[model samples]
Every structure is written in structure tokens, then in C-alpha cells.
Target: MENTMVFEEPMTAEKCSGHLSSVEDAIYVIGGKWKLKIIIALHENGNIRFNELQRIVAGISARVLSNELKDLELNGFVKRVVHAEQMPVVVEYISTDYSRTLKPVIMALSEWGRKHKKNIREDLF
Candidate 1:
């Protein structure tokens, strides 16, 4: 079974009516189809340029990647470094200290994905 780590508790009337916790906001920022993927990609590569990141994480469109990068930067999980070059400078996305907190979450997701894929392949075969 895939044990994906969720950032929010069970949504109930009480939880919904009340303010979300910091953990909840953290989850909200990093909890998405592509948000975590971006984090992991930056982590593995240390620092990567915008276009390079778009290429590494397949299937994410340019607009979505750009928007997510902005969100991550806004949430302080990513640091955007702008290089001072000639025409058409470069911007690199680097993982911030806040992102390190999701290390265990990433580990769990990786293990779950590996197990789930193996199970699927086994069933198919």
C-alpha cells in the first residue's frame, strides 16, 4: 500500500471552521501533485536553473512549474538566485532550510512508491 504523508488532519467541521495550524499551512504549500516533486528535484540537484528544472520533472507544463516555483519561493521553501550576467540572465532554485523538514516525508513517499510500483508490476505480470 502507498502510505503518502498528508499535511492536514482529517477535515471536520471544527477543523474547517477554525484556523489551520502552521503544520497545516506547511502541508498546504508542499502538499500537491507537483510541489513535492519540485522540492525533491532541487534537493537532489542542489541548484538548478528554471528551464533545466522544467526538463527534469517531466509532464509539468511551463506555466505550472513557474507558478509552483513562485509559491515555493513565497513560502520560503525555495530560494531563487538570480545571476548577474549579460542579456538573458539565469535564475536558479535552491532548497531552503525549511524544506529540510520534509526529508522524512520524502523518504516515506519514496518507499511507498517503490513498493506500490513493484506490486503493480507483479500483478500485471
Candidate 2:
């Protein structure tokens, strides 16, 4: 049997309100069009340079990537490291341990996305 995390208890009224607030807070932090994608890329690639991240994310302009990375760093989900040893200097972005807390959420979303795509494909055909 596969081990899966589950919430066994039903949410109480207070718990429901707290959960909703927490979800709203989370959405506010990572709510932008590019924030979660940027986080996922950093999580997958580990430490990545700015240019590389832009390439990996695709369709994001340098300005937008810069803005999003700053937001992620500000939100404590990502860290920006600068290496001065390189000739031209280098900057890299890495996911924080705090960001790892979202792994399960990301995985669940990925699983749902796969199923959604399959359902759409089936419906179309």
C-alpha cells in the first residue's frame, strides 16, 4: 500500500475559519502568475542562476522574473545568493527550507493537473 498523508478529522467551525484564513494568506503570498512556477523551478533545480531560471520558466521576461524572485525572497520562500568570486559575479536563487513545506501541496497540484489534462483530452476526443 502507498503511504499517503491524510487529515482524518473533520474540520470544526473554528478550524474551518482558520484554514480559510491560512489558505488566503498562502494565496496572497504565492498568488502571482509566476510565483509558484518560480518556486517549483527553484525547488527542482536547486541553486540556479538568474538567466537559467528565466530560461527554465519560459515566457517570463527578465523584468518579471526579477520582480517575482524579489517577491519570493521577500516572502521567505527563496534565497538569493551572490557569488563575487566569479569574474563578472553571479547571482543564484535557491529554495528555502520553509519553501519545502509546500512540497506536498505542489505534488497534489501536479497530480490533479495530470488528471485534469487527461480528462480534458478524453472529453475532447
Query: Per-residue lDDT for 1-125 in model 1, tens only?
Result: 45765646776777655546756866787888999999999999998998899999999999999999999999888999988784678788999999888899889989979988999999999
TM-score of each: 0.71, 0.82
Clash counts for all predictions: 0, 0
lDDT of 2 by residue, 1-125 (tens): 24664667976899879989999998999887899899999989999999999999999999999999888889899999999999899998999999999999989988989988998999999
The positional error of residue 34 in candidate 1, measured at the CA in angstroms, is: 0.6
Best by TM-score: 2
Per-residue error (Å), model 2, residue 63: 0.8
Q: Lowest lDDT 10-mer window, candidate 1?
A: 14-23
The lDDT values for all models are 0.88, 0.91
Candidate with best lDDT:
2
TM-score of 2: 0.82
